[model samples]
Target chain A: MNKFREGGWHILLLLICLVLLLPVVFMISNSFKTLQDSYHSMLQIIPLHPTFSNYTTLGRQIDLLRLIWNTFFMAAIVTLGKLITGLFAAYAFKYFSFKGKKWIYLIFVSTIFVPFTVIMIPNYLVISKINLLNTAPGVALPQMCDATGIMLFLKAMDKIPKSLIESLKIDGISSHMILKDIIIPILRPSIISIGAIFFINSWNEYVWPTLILKDKSSFTLPLALQNYISSEGGTNFPLAMALSTIMIIVPLFIYLIFQRYILNSISNSGLK
Target chain B: MNSSGSKNKFLTIAYLSPTAVILLVFMVIPILYTLYLSFFDWNLISPTKNFVGLENYTSIFTDSVNRKVLLNTIVYILLLLILNFIIPYFISLIVKFFINKMKNSYKIIFFIPSLFSLVVGAMLFSWIMNPISGPVAFLMRHFGVALPNWTNSSAMAIVMLCLITNWKVFGYNFVLLLTGLGSIPQNIIDATKIDSIPRWKMVRDIVLPLNKSIAFYVLILTIVQGLQYVFTPISVITQGGPYYGSSNIFYHTYLNAFVLYKTGNASALAVITFLVFLILLYLEMKFVEGRMGNCE
Candidate 1:
C-alpha cells in the first residue's frame, strides 16, 4: 500500500515536470520538423516525420563550427579566469589579514549586485580603447570575475582548518605551496562544480557578448541565433530551433555529469 | 592588520592584486565613469563631452515614455516576484513534502529549462503562444476562446516577459527552497508528526521559519538579478515594442545609448540603477556578513 502511494506521487511529480518543461519539449520536437511542418505541427509533442534537413540548412547558412568554437573557447577562458582569480582572492581573504580587508571583501562579493547596464557603457568604451572589440577575449574579459565564483570559493575555503594552515606555515611552507598542496586537493569538488556553473553561464551569455562580438566570425552560439531572428521578423523557425537544440547539448551534458556537486554546492551555500 | 608573520603582508597584497585590478578596471571605474558621463552629453564617438549639468537627469524624469518605462519596471518587479519567487517557493514545498519518491529527479528534471538561454525560451514561447498560429491559440479556438494579444498591451507584455523568466528560472528557486526544506531538523519534523499537527500548519509554523535564510537569498536574487534575464527575451521577442510597452529601465537605457546614441541619458539611468541596487545590496551584505562572522 505504501509503495503504491509512492508510485502515485511519482506520477504526479512527472506530470508537473512535463507541464513546466513543455517549452523545452516543444523546442526539441520542432527542431526535427520541416519548415512547413514546424508551422503545422505546433501542437504535437513529437514530430510526425522527423528530418535532419533543418540542421544541414542551418549549417549552410551560418558558420556553425566557428560559432561553437567561439562559445566553447570563451566559456573555457571565463571558467579558468574566474576560478584562478576567485581562488586567489578568496585565499587572501581567508588566510591573511590586511588593511580595509572587510570592506574590500564586501566590495568583491557585492559585485553580485552591480547592475550590468551600469558598467556596459564604460566597459564598452574601455574595450574599444584597448582594441578588444569584436574579439572573444573582449566578451570573456568583462565577465571573468562575477561574485558567485568568489563567494563559492570563500565558502569552500572556510572548511579547511586553521591549525592545518598554521602547521604548514610553521614548517616554512610558502603560501603558494600551502595553497597548492593542502587547500586545492580538499577543494577539488567545489572547484569543479563552480567551474561548471561559470562555464555554463558564459556559454549562455548574450547581452555582453552582443555588445562586444559584432562580427559574425566572433559570434557566440546565442548571438548566432539572433541573426536568424533578424531585426525584422522573417524568422526561419525550424533552422533556428535546430540551432538552439545544438546549443543546449553542452550545458545539459555538464548538468547531468556534475549534478550532484552542483546540487550540494547550492544547498550548502544556501544553508549558511 | 597583520597575520602571525609580518612579512606575509606582501604576499597578501600579491594574492589580492589580480582581483583588485579586475574589479577596479571593470566594476569600480565603469561605475564612476558612468556617473561622470551622466553629467555631460556625448555621442560616444564625439571628440568633446558637452557638459550639461543636470539636464540628463531632468529629461529622464520629465519624459513621458521614460515614466511609462519606470512604471513598467515596477510592474515587472512585482510580477517577477510572483512568478519567479513565490510560485516556485510553494511548488518546492509541495514537491518536498507531498512527493515521497525521486525528489532529486524532480529537481534535476525541473532545472533542465534553466540550462537553456532565454533567447531560446523567447523563441519557443513566441511560436507556441503565437495568437494565430500557436498551439495554445489553436487549441483555444476550438473552445471559442478569444485571446488578447499580450505583446500589444503593456500590462500583459510585462506579465508575459515575467512568465518567460519564470519558465527559465523556476527550477532554480524551487530547488533552493527544497534545499532549505531539507535543512530542517528531522527531530523537529518527527516531533510535529508525533503531535499529529496538520501538514499545512506544520509547514507554516515549523518549516517556513527554518528556511528563512535560503528564502531570503532567493528573494534577493530574484529581485536584484531576475529582470536582467528578461533582457534577452525582450530584445528577441518584443524589442520592447508596441510603443515601448515592455521596456524596463535597463532596456530603455540600452536603447538610449546604443540605438539613439544618447550616452548622457543612459549614463544617468545607469547611475540611478546603481544607487538603487547599492542600497539593497548593502543591507544584504550586512546580513550575510553577520552570519559569516566579522573580520578574519
Candidate 2:
C-alpha cells in the first residue's frame, strides 16, 4: 500500500512533466524531420528518418553563425555592464546615509515600473537621432543597467555584518580597497546568480532589437528567426523548427548549467 | 567630519553616476519626450510637424477602432490574470504541499519554457498549432475530431495568444509563488499537526494569510509583465490580425507608430499606458509588503 502511494505520485508527476515538456520535445523531435514528413507524421515523437538538410537550410537563408554571435555579444556586453554599474550603485546605496537617500532609492526602483511601451518611441527616436540604429551597442546600451541587480546586491551587502566593514574602516582603508578585498569575494555567489538572470534576459530580448537593428548583418537570433519566417513562410516547417532549436539551445543549456543559481535568484525575489 | 562628509558625497555621486546616467538618458528622458510628442502630429521622417493638441487623446475615446483596441486590451489583462496569476497561484500551492518527491525536477521542467525567447515560442506554437499541417491538428483528425481554426476568429485568436503567453509565463509565475510559499516558517505547519487540520484547511487558513505579500507582488507583476509578454506572440502570429481583432494597447501603440507612422497617436497611447500602470504601481507601493518587492 505504501509503495503504491509512492509510485502513484511519481507516475503522476512524470506524466505532468511529459505533457508540459511536449512543446520542447516536439520542437527537437520535429526539427530532425523532412518537410513532407513534418506535415504527415504527427504521431512520430522521433523522426522515422532524420537528416541535417533542414539544419542546412538555416545556413542558406541567413548568416546563422553571425546571428548567434550578435545575440551572444549583446547578451554578454549587457550582462557585464549591468554587473559593474549595478555593483557601484548598490555599494553607494548601502554606504550612503544621506538626507535624501530614501527619495533617491525610490527613483532608482521606479524604473522597474516604467512600462517599456511608454519609453519605446522616445528611445527609438533618441537612438536614431544619435545615428545608433543598426548597431549592437545601440541595442545593448539601453539595457545595461537594471534595478534588480542593484537591489539583489544591496540586500546581499546588507547581510554582511556592519562590524566587519567598520573594523576595517578604523585602519583608514580606502573604499576601493575595501570593495576589492572584501565586498567582491563575499558577494561572488550572488553576483553569479544575478548575472545568470541578466544574461538570459538579454539573450531573449526581442522588441528593442527589432526597433534598433536594421541591417541583416546586425540582426540577433530572434529577429533573424522572424525574418526567416516572413520570407520563407509555409515553404518549410522543419527548417523553422531547426532555427528555433538553435536559438533555444544556448539559453536552455545556460539554464540547465546554472539552474540552481537562476532558480535561487528568482526565489529570492519574492521572499525579500 | 566636514571634509569626510564632502568626500563621501563626491564618492556617492561617482559610484552612482553609471546607473543614474543610463536611467536618466534611457528612462526619464523617454517618458518626458513621449509626453511631449503626444501633443503633436509628426510622420517621424518628414521635418514638418502639426500641432494636434488634445485631438489624439480625444480620438482615443471617440474613435471606434481605438475603443475596440482598448476593449481588447482589457480582455488581454483578464485572460493574462487567469493564465499567469490566479492559476499559477493555486498550482504553486499544490506543488508545494502535494506530490513532493523530485520537487527540484518539477521546478526545472516547469521553468524550461520560460528560458526560451518569446519569438521561439511564437514560432514553435504557430508550427505546432497550424490548422492545416500542424501535428496537433493531424493528431486530432485521427480521433474523429475536427480542429477549429482558432486563429481566424478574433476572440479565439486572442485566447490562443494568451495561451502562448501562459506557456512561457506560467512556469515563471509558479516558481515565484512556490518560493513565496517556502518562506512560511516550518513551526506554523508543525503546530497545526496537533489539530490534524485537513490539508486544504491548513492551506486556506495558515498558508494564504502568510503568503499575502508575495501574492500581491506576483499579482502586480502578472498584470505588468504579462501584457508585455503577450506582445511578441501578437506581432509574430496574428499581427493583431483578422481586422485588428487581437490588438491590445501595447501592440496597437507599436502598430500606430511604426506600422502606420502615426507618431502622435502612438505617443498619446503610450502616455495613457504609462499612467495606467503608474496607478497600479502606486497601489502596489501602498498595499504590498515592503520586503517582497524589495531585492527584486
Candidate 3:
C-alpha cells in the first residue's frame, strides 16, 4: 500500500511540474510558427510549418536591438547603483555605532512596505520637473535605492567577524581598504546573487519605465512589447510571440547562468 | 580620540548619504507629495490647480463604481493570498517530499514563469487564452467543451487574472516555503520518526510551528505586493475591461492618471490605497511579532 501511494505521488508531482511548464513550452514553440499556423493550429505543440518571418518582421517593425540594449543598459545601471549604495549603507549600519543608527535603519527598511503605486504620480512629477523623463538614467535612478538589497547586504555583513575588522584596523587599514580587501571577498557570492536579482527585476520592470519613458526610441523591451501588443490587438499572434520570446531571452539566460546564486541569496535572505 | 570619533561619524554620514538622500527625495517626499496632491484637481499638464477639499475621498466612498473597484481590489487580494501563498505553501511541502534528489532542477523548472517579464507573461497568456484561435479554445473544441473568452468575459476575467498571477508567483513562494521546510532541523525529524508519530501529526506539531515566521513573511508579502502583481495582467491582457470587471484599485488609479490623465483622482486613490495597506502592514507586523516572541 505504501509503495502504491509513493508511485501515485511521483506521478502527481510530474503532472504538476508539467502544468507549470506548459505555458513556457507553448510560448517557445509557437514563436517559430507562421501567423496562419499559430491561429489555425493552436493545439499543436510543434509547428508544422516553422518560419523566421515573425522574428524578421519584428526586427523591421521595431528597433528590437535598441530595445534589447536599452533594457540591458538600464538593468546594469540600476544593479550597479543598488550594489554600491546598498553596500555603503549596509557597511555603515553594520560597522559603525552612530547616533540614530537604529532609527535610520528602520526608516530605510520601512520603505519596503511603501508600494510603488503610492509614489508613482509624485515621482513622475519630480522626474518630469528635472527633465529626466525619456532618459535611461531617469528610468533607473528612483528604483536604485533598494531596501531589500541593503537588508540582504547588512545580514551578510553582520556574519563577518568583528575581530577581523579590528585586526585590519590595527594594521592602519582605512575602512574602505578593509572593505575592499576583506568584506567584499567574503560577501562576493551574496553580492552576485543580489546583483542577479537586481538585474532581473529592473530588466523586467514595466510600469515605472512606461510612466517615465515617453519617446518611442527610448522604450524598454517590456514597454515596447506592451505597446506592440496593444497596438496590434491580437491581429498578429506569431509576431507578438516572437517579440515576447526576444524580450525574455536575456533574462532567462541570466537566470539560467546564475540560478544557483539567485536561489542561494533568496534562501539566505528573507527576500521573495 | 575625539578626532578619531568625529572622523568615524563623518565616514558614517558619507557612506549612508546616498541611500538616505535617494529614499528621502524619491520615496519619502513623493509619499508626502502624493498625500498633498490628493486634495487638488489637476490634470498634470495644466498650470493651474484647484483645491477640492475632501471631495475625492467622498466620491471614493459614495460613488458606486469606485466602491465596486475597492471591493474588487479586496477580492483580488484575498484570492491572491489564498491561491498565491496558501495553496503553494502546501504544494511546496508535497514537492519537498517527492523531489529529494532533483530538487534544484525542479525548482528552476517551476521558477521559469517568474523569470519572464510580467509584460511578456501577460502577452504570452493573452495568446494562450485567446478565445478564438488560442490553445485553450482549440483544446476545448477537441474536448467538446466551451471555453469562454477568458479575458473578455466579466465573470471569468478576474478569476483568470488571479490564476495567471498565481502562475507567475507560485514558484517564488514555493521556493520560499521550501526553504522554510529545509530549515526544519533534522534532529527533530529523527525524534519524530523514532516516536513513530503519524506523518501529518509530525508536520503539524514539529514543522508548522517552526515555519510560522517564514509563512507569516510570505503572507505579508502577498498582501503588500498584491497590487503590483495584478497590475500587469490587468493592463496587458484585460485592460481591466468588460466594463471595469477586473479593474483593481491599482490599475484603476493607473488608468485615471496615465490613460485618462485625471491626476487628482489617481493621487486620491493612491493615498487611500496606501492607508489601507499601512493598516494591513501594522496588523501583520503585530501578529508576527507576537508569534515570534512565543516561538522564542
Candidate 4:
C-alpha cells in the first residue's frame, strides 16, 4: 500500500511539472522557427528549418544594450532608495515611541491597499508640472518608495529582541549607529529579501512607464518590446516569441541566481 | 535650541525622509487630489476648470458604461482570486509533498514569468494563444479540432486574461504558500500521528486550522492587487478586446484619461475604483484580523 501510494504521488508530480513547463518549452521551440514556419499547419510542434535569424533581426530592431541598461539602472536605483527609506521607517516604527505612530503606521499599511488607478491622473499631472515628464527620473521617481516593503521591513525589525536595543542604549550608541552598525547587520537577510522584491517589482512595472515615457529613445526593454510586438503584422509570431524568449530568460536567470532571497521576500509579504 | 538632541531627531527623519516623502507626495497626495478632481470638470488643454459638486459621482451611478466597468471589476477580482489563490494553494502543497530536493529551483522557475515586465508576459501569452498560429491552435489541429479565437470573445477573453495573470503570479503565490507550509511546526504533525488521525483529518484539524491566518492574508493580498488594474494584458493582448470583454474599471479609467483625454469621466471612474478598494480592504481587515486572533 505504501509503495503504491508513493508511486501515485510521483506520477501526479510528473504530470504537474509537465503542465508547468509546457509554455516555456513551447516558447523556446517556437522562437527558433522562421516566420513562415510558424504559420504553416504541419510545422507546429517542431521547426523543420530552425534559424537564429529572428534573434539577429531582434538585435537590429531595438537598441538592446541601451534598453537593458535603462531598465537595470531604473530598477537598481529604486531598489536602493526603497531599501534605505524602508529601513529607516521600519526602525522608527519598531523602536521610537513618537506620537501618532499608530495613525502613521495605519496610513503606511493603508497605502498598500490603494490602487494606482485612483492616483494615476493626479500623479501624471504632478510629474508634468515638475518638468520631469518624459524623463527617466519621472518614470522611476513615483515608484521609488513602496509601502509594502517598508511594512515588511518594519515587521521584521519588530522581531529583533528589545534586549538588543537596550544593549545599544547602554553603550551610548545613537539610533543612527544602532541602525547602521547593529540593526542593518542583523537585518541583512530581510534587506536582501526586500531588495530582490523591489528590484523585481520596479523591473516588471509597465503602466506607469508607458504613461511617463513617450520618447522611443527613452523606452525601457518592456516598453520597447511592446512597441516591437505590436508594430509588426500578427504573422510575425516567431519574432515576437524570440523577443519574449529573451525578456523571459533574463529575469528567469536573475531569479534563479537569487531564488533563495526572492522566496524569502515572498514569504515576508505574507507575514505582514 | 538644543543642538545635539535636535540633531538626532533630524538624523532619523532625514534617513526616513526620502522614502516617506516620496510615498506621501506621489502616492498619498495624488490619490487625494484625484478624489478632489472627480468633483470638477477639468480638461488638460483648457485653462478653464469648472467645479461641479457631486455631478461626476452621480454620473457614475447613472452611466451605463461606468456601471458595466464596476461589474467587470468585481468579476475580474473574483476570477483572479480563484486563479491566484485556490489554484496556487493546492499547487504549492503538491509541489512541497512531491519535490523535496529541487523545491527552490521550482519556486524560481515559477516566479520567472512574474519577474518579467507585465507587457512582455502579456505579449508572450498573446502569441501563444493566437487563433491562427498560437500553440493552442496548433495543438487543437493536431487532435483534429478547430479552436476558436480565445481573445476574440468578450467572455472568453476575460477568462483567458485571468488565466494568463494567474500563470504569471502563480509562482509567487506558491512560494508564499510554501513558506506558510514550512512554518507549520513538525511537532503538530507528530501529535496527529500519535493520535492516529487519518490523513484527511490531520489536514483538516491541524494544517488548515494552523495556517488559516496566512491563507487569509494571501487571499486579501491577491484580491487587492487584482483590483488595482492589470494594464499590460489589457493594453497589449486585448486592448479591452473584441468588444470590451477584458476591460475592468481601472483599465477603463486609464482609457478615459489617457486615450480619450476625458479627465472628468476618468476621475469619476477612479473615485469609484477607490471606494471599491476601500470597501473590500475594510471587509478583509475586519474579518481576517478577527479570525487570525482566533487562530491563536
Candidate 5:
C-alpha cells in the first residue's frame, strides 16, 4: 500500500511537470519546422521534416546580432550602475548614524510601492527633454534607481558584524579602504547574486525599451521580437516561434549558469 | 576631534548622494511631475501648457468607456488575485505534501518559464493559441471537438490573459510559498504528531497560522503587481480588444499617452491607479494585522 501511494504521487507530479514544460518544449520543436510543417504538424512535439529555414529567414529580416548586442550592452551597464549606487547607499544606511536616517531609508524603500505606470509619462518627458531618447543610456539610466537592490544590499550588509568594521577603523583605515578591503570581499556572493538579478531584469525589460527606443538599430531583443510578431511575421507561426526561441536562448543560458544565485536572490527579495 | 566630526558628516552625505540624486531626479521628481501634469492640458508635443484643474479627472469619471476600463481594471486585479495567489498557494501545499528528495529540481523546472522575458512567453502563447494553425485547434480536432477563438472571443480573452499570467507567475509564487512552508518549526510538527491531531486540523491550526505573514506578502504583491503583469499579454495577444473587451486601466493609460496624445488624461489615470494601490495596501495591512492579533 505504501509503495502504491508513493508511485501514484510521483505519477501525478510528473503529469503536472509535463503540463508546465509543454509550451517551452513546443516552442523549441516548432522553431525547427518549416512554415508549412508548423501549420500542418501543429500538435506534433517533433517535426517530421525539420528544417532551419525559419531561423535563416529571421536572420534576413532583422539584424539579429545587433539586436542581441544592444540588449547585452544595456543589461551590463544597468547592472553595473545599480550595483555601484546600491552599494554606496546601503553602506551609508548600514554603517552611519545620522539625522533622519530612518526616514531617508524609508523614502528609498518606498519607491517600490509606486508602480512604474505612475511615473512613466514624466520619466518619458524627462528623458526626451534631455535628448537621451532612442539612446542606450536613455533606456538604462532611469532604471538605475533600484530600491530592491539597495534593500538587498542593506540586508546583506547588516549580516556583517560591526566589530570587524570598527577594528579596521582603529587600524587607521579610511572608510573607503574598509569598503574596498573588508566589505566587498565579504559581500562577494551577494554582489554576484544581485548583479545577476539586475542583469536579467534589464535584459527582459520590454515596456520601457518599447517606449524609449525608436530606431530600428537601437531595438532590444524584446522589442525586435514584438516587431516581428506585430508587423513582419504576421500569422507566420514558425517565424515568430523562431524569433522567440532566439530571444529565450541568451537569458536561458545565463539562467542555467547562475540558476542558484538567481533563485537565491528572487526567493530572498520576494519581489518580482 | 572637530575635524573628524565634520569629516564624518561629509562622508555620510557623499556615500548617500549618488543614490539619492538618482532617486530624486528620476523617481521622486517624475512622480511629483506626474501629479502636476494631471492638472494640466498639454499635448506631449506642445510648447505651451494650459492648466485645466480637475477637468481630466472629471472626464474619466464621466466617460462611459473609461468607466468600463476602470471596471475591467478591478475585475482583472480580482481575477488575478484568485488565479495568481489563491490557486498557487494551494498548489504549493500539494507539492509540499508529495515532494521528496527531488524538491530542488522540481522548483528549478517550475521557474524555467519565468526566466524567459514576458514578451517571449506572450508570443509563444500567441502561437500555441493560434486558431488556424495552433496546438489547441490541432488537439481539439483529434478529439473531434472544437476550440473557440481563444484570444478573439470577448468573454474568453480576459480569462485567457489571466491564465497566461498565472502560467508565467505560478512558479515564482510557488517557490515563495515553499520557503514559507519550510520555515515552519519542526518541533511544532513533531509535537502535533504526538497529540495524534488530525492532519487537516493540525495544518489549519499550526501550518496556516505560522505561514500567515508570507501568505499575506504574496497576496499584497499579487494585488500591487497585478496591473502591470497583464499589460504585456493584452498588448501582444489581444491589443486590449476585439473592441475593448480586455482593456484595463494600465492599457487604457498607455493608449491615452502614446496612441491618442491625451497626456493629461493618462496622467490622471496614473494618479488614480496609484491611489487605488495605496488604498488596497492599507486594507491588506489592516487585515493581516487583525488576523495575526486574533491568532495571538
Candidate 6:
C-alpha cells in the first residue's frame, strides 16, 4: 500500500507541476519567436525558429533601467519602512506592558478589515492637498504603516520565552537593550519573511499608483506594461511580449531571492 | 522612576502613532470623505459640492444597468470563490506529496506567480491569451481547436481573470497548507495507518480536521482578495469591459471615484462592499475560533 501510494502521488504531483509551468514555458518560448510566428502559433510550446528580436525591440521602446530602478526603489523603501515601524510597535507592545495596549493593538488590527478603497478618496485628497501626487514618496508612503505587519510581529514576539527576558533583567539589561540584543536577533527569520512579503506586495501594487500617478516618466514597470498592452500596438507584438516577459521576470527574480522567507510566511500566516 | 513610567507611556503612544495616524488620515478620513461626497452631486472636477441625500444609492437600485453591474459582481465573486478553493487545495495536495521527496524548491517555483504585481500578471496573461501570439491560443491551435477570444468575451474574460488570479494566489495557499502539513506529527499519521484508515479517510478524518485552522484563513483571504480583484485586471487590462460584462462592485466603485468622479456614489458602493466583507470576515472568525482544535 505504501509503495503504491508513493508511486501514485509522485506521478500526480509531477503532472500537476507540468500544468502549472506550461503558461510560463509558453511565455518564454514565444518571447524567442517573431511576432507573426508568436501570433500564428500562439499555443506552441516549442518555437519553430527562435529569435532575440523581441528583446532588442523591447529595449528600444521603453526606458527599462528607469522602470526597474523605480520599482525596486519603491519596493525597497516600503519594505524597510514597514519593518522599522512594525518592529518598533511590536517590541513596545511585547516588552513594556502598558494600559490600553490591547485596545490599541485591536484598533490597529481593525484597520486591516477596511478595504483600501474606503480610504482611496481621502488619501487622494491628502496627497493632492499636500501636492505630493505623482511622486515616488506618495506611492511608497501609504505602505509604511501596516497593521498586519505589527500583528504578525507581535504574535512572533509573544512566542519568545519569558525566561530570556527575566535572565536579561537579572543581568541589569534595560528593555531597549533587550529589544536590540535579544528580541531583534531572535526575530530575524520573522523580519526576513515579513520584509519579503512587504516587498512583494509593494512591488506588485497597481491601483494606488494608477490612481495617484499621472506622468509616464514616473510610471512603475506594472503601469508602464499596462499602457503597453492597453495600446496593444497590434504590429508591435514582439515589443509587447518582450515587455511582458521582463515585467514577470523582475518579480520572479525577487521570489527566487526570497523564496524561503516567502514560503515560511505563507504557511505561518495560514496557521494564524 | 516616574520619568521612566511616563516615558514608557510615551513610547507606547509613539508605537501606536504611525498606524493610528495613517489609518485615520488615509482610511478613516477617506471613508468619511467618501461618505460626505456620496451625499453630494459633485463631479470630481467641479469646485461646487451640492448635497443630495441618498439619491445616488437610490439611483443604483433603480437604474437597470447598475443592477446588472451588481449581478455581474455577484457572479464574478461566486466564480472566484469556487476557483480559489479547488485550485489551491489540489495544488497544496500535490505539494504535500512532493515535500517528502524534494525540498519545497518546487513549491517555491510554482508559487512564483504570487509575487508578481497584478499589472504584471494581467499583462503577462494578456500576452499569453493574445489571440495571435498568446500561449492559450497557441495550445488550442496545437490541438487543432479553434480558440475563441477568451479575454474579449465578457463571461470568458471573468473566468480567465479568475484563472489568472488563482494561478498567482494558489501558491500562497499551497505554501501555507504545506506548512500546516509540515507541523503535523508523523506519529499521528502512523496512528491513522495502524487504525486501518484508508488513505482518503486518513486525509478526510485526520488531515482535514487538523488543518481546519489554516483552511479558515485560506477562505477569508480568498474572499477578501476575490472581492478586491476588481482593481487589478479591471484597471490594468480590461478596464472592466468589452462592455460591463466583467465589472464588479469594486471596479464599479473605482470607476465612480476615479473616472466619473462621482465620489458620492462610489462611497456608497464602497460602504456596501465593506459591509459585505465585514459580514463574511465575521463568519470566518467564528468558524475558526469556535470549537476548532490544536492550532489554537
Q: Which structure is stronger by DockQ: 5 or 6?
A: 6
Please give, for residues B65-142, the per-residue lDDT of candidate 5 as tens digits: 899888888788889999989877876776665445567887898888777788877787777766656678788888
What tens digits encode model 6's per-residue C-alpha lDDT throughout B191-226?
976987776777778888887866777777777777
lDDT of 6 by residue, A180-224 (tens): 888889998888888878887888788778877888778887887
Best by TM-score: 2
DockQ of every model listed? 0.63, 0.63, 0.57, 0.52, 0.51, 0.52
Model 3: per-residue Cα lDDT over A1-272, one tens digit each = 76676667677667778877887777778889987787777668989998888898888888888998999999999999999999988888887788777667767876876877799888888899999999999999888856777778876776688888888877878999988988899999889989998898899998789889989999999888787675224557777778888877877888878898888777755532
lDDT by residue for model 1 over B1-296, one digit each (tens)? 24545678778888888888988999989999999999999998899999999999999889999899888888888888898899889878877776666777888888888888888888777766677667788889889996767778777777778888888888877877788888788999899889999778999998988787678778888987787888888888888987999999989999998989999999999998888897777666565445443337
Compared with the true structure, what per-residue lDDT tens digits does model 2 show for residues A195-216? 9889888999988998899888
- List the pairs of residues colliding in candidate 2: none
Evaluate all candidate structures by whole-model CA lDDT and list the values in order. Answer: 0.83, 0.84, 0.81, 0.74, 0.81, 0.73
Better of 3 and 5 by DockQ: 3
Model 1 chain B poorest ten-residue lDDT run: B286-295
Higher-lDDT candidate of 5 and 6: 5
After superposition, candidate 4 runs with Cα above 4 Å error: A40-50, A155-161, A231-235, B1-8, B95-108, B288-296
**Model 1 Cα lDDT, one tens digit per residue, A1-272:** 75776677678678868877777777788889987887777767788998999999987888889989999999998899999988888888888877888888777777866889999999999999999998888899999757666677888877888888988888889999988988899999999999988898899999999889888888999988877764344577778889999999999999889998887776655555
Docking class of 5: medium
What is candidate 2's CAPRI-style docking category based on DockQ? medium
Worst 10 residues of 5 chain B by lDDT: B287-296
Question: Candidate 1: lDDT over CA atoms?
Answer: 0.83
The TM-score of candidate 3 is 0.95
RMSD of 5: 3.2
Candidate 2 vs 5: which has more lDDT: 2
Pull out the clashing pairs in model 4.
Answer: none
Kindly report which residue stretches of model 3 are placed more than 4 angstroms away from their true locations once superposed.
A231-233, B97-99, B289-296
By lDDT, is 2 or 4 better? 2
